[model samples]
Target: HGGLVAAGEMTRTYLWRILFRDQVPPETALLLDNNAEFTGTVRNSRTLWQQDFEQPAPGLCGTPALQGGCSLALDAAHPHSTEWVIPARPGQFKWVRASAKARADQMEWDMNRMTQYVIRFRRGNEIVKARTVRLQRALVDAGWPRELHFDVRPPKADFDNVSVTFLYYGTTANLLLDNARLEAFDD
Candidate 1:
């Protein structure tokens, strides 16, 4: 005669006891059961990180910012930089959009021009740099802030880190950076 060996609950209880070496606590098991309901579902795009540079001393070298005090100032002498480490998750995020607001009074010339901004995605030995967006000279005349944007499709699977850098590249322009954000979108 053949019959079912065990139910799902029975198997789960056996494994839990074996793993924890004790009976599952009621509160802990309830919390796990509740969380299991939301697994394998898609949520809204998450804000991986954001920085307004509101710190009293911002940037890697603690550079002083301008008045209003919510931005980082970078020049050929000091290039404000920051980084984020992504976790090792399988198929969690497919694309990333990075954005920031900036303005410059002057820039260093590298035959072409100074880079307004750069985004770097790095994991293991693979590294991808989003194309540099050139700063326009008119912003100085208009005295208005310019928005910088970059969309990066990670080159290889399992990208575990990203670096957002504002480079002066030998330019004399004093670049003002504010409202930097990294957003992840699911496909």
Candidate 2:
């Protein structure tokens, strides 16, 4: 009899808690989203243009970005085109290195003329430096992802902007770019 009564009391207490207990409202969870600016540091490096190509931001063009998100598929139609323009404070960065995993479907392609890409730095209206990697044609023809790294030391004075460009020279090629990074260094 005592065991039965204890069980009944426990069940009643559980039911009462379920019916009368207070919960934290859903509105409280939505408070942080209203703030416009982020207060913390998002990236560790002093990178100038580190584009994972996740979002369509202020400085990109000729990019019909990949369908599900991740990379930029540069439009073959836009030859000798500057894809991204990133602004920088004068003299903030000394050395710059641009790198990416690039691939192409065409076997016989000429990077020297047809598909030349350049990482150019500018100061106001003057071009400070332009760097391009001279990749071997056989390496690209293997149908494997090639790692391209182009480094440049811009003029120590000052620069207004830098451009990530593709000098297609009016030729079409099936190219894919991923994990593109334009990192800046003090040295």
Candidate 3:
């Protein structure tokens, strides 16, 4: 229902015709699926993989999402593991920062190594480079959500893909991730 409404109509077209259209956000040319907001109706043009956990899954969507809807959730009982791939055009940027709003439900347990995002650079089916950023015990265990990011240099001159894999193999910690972003910038 992002651009469509009931009766198989487009809300934007209808609103425009009625002269009641709201302000529309400008189209971005950098990346797609920077936020995990789209349903199956819309395609992610840039990314090869992303998460849309709209349907209820175990420990998923337990709390309100930071942006559009549903965050990636992991519980000790579930031990969720998933990966997200974003298009990497390293020639146009100096660095890419991958970030998300991440938090742990309780602070009494060790958070380090409990959850981590493994960033990988791939060319075709081969992995060229990788870096794993574990959730910091002090930052995420502060009893609140925080914006965590890993500033990564793009893989090599010929690399074409970057992926982040979320892994949790703990028995006592619960984690939540929302509003993921992959930004390639010159600065």
Cα RMSDs, all models: 20.7, 21.8, 15.1
For model 2, residues 23-96, the per-residue Cα lDDT tens digits are 42222111111111122333344777766656633343324433235444544444443368888765666566
Estimate the TM-score of every prediction. 0.57, 0.55, 0.60
Across 46-95, the per-residue lDDT of candidate 1 in tens digits comes to 87777887762444332333335557765444654544455434365766
Give the range of the ten consecutive residues with the poorest summed lDDT in model 2.
28-37
Candidate 1: where is the Cα deviation over 4 Å? 1-43, 56-68, 88-90, 106-113, 124-131, 135-142
lDDT (CA) for every model shown? Answer: 0.50, 0.50, 0.54
Candidate 3: lDDT over CA atoms? Answer: 0.54
Candidate ranking (TM-score, best to worst): 3, 1, 2
Best by TM-score: 3
lDDT of 1 at 171: 55
Kindly list the per-residue Cα lDDT of model 3 for residues 29-108, writing each as its tens digit.
00111221121232222323445455546566746665566777776665655566666655756565666677666643
Quote the lDDT for 184 in model 1.
71
In model 1, which residue pairs have backbone atoms overlapping below 3 Å?
Answer: 106-173, 108-171
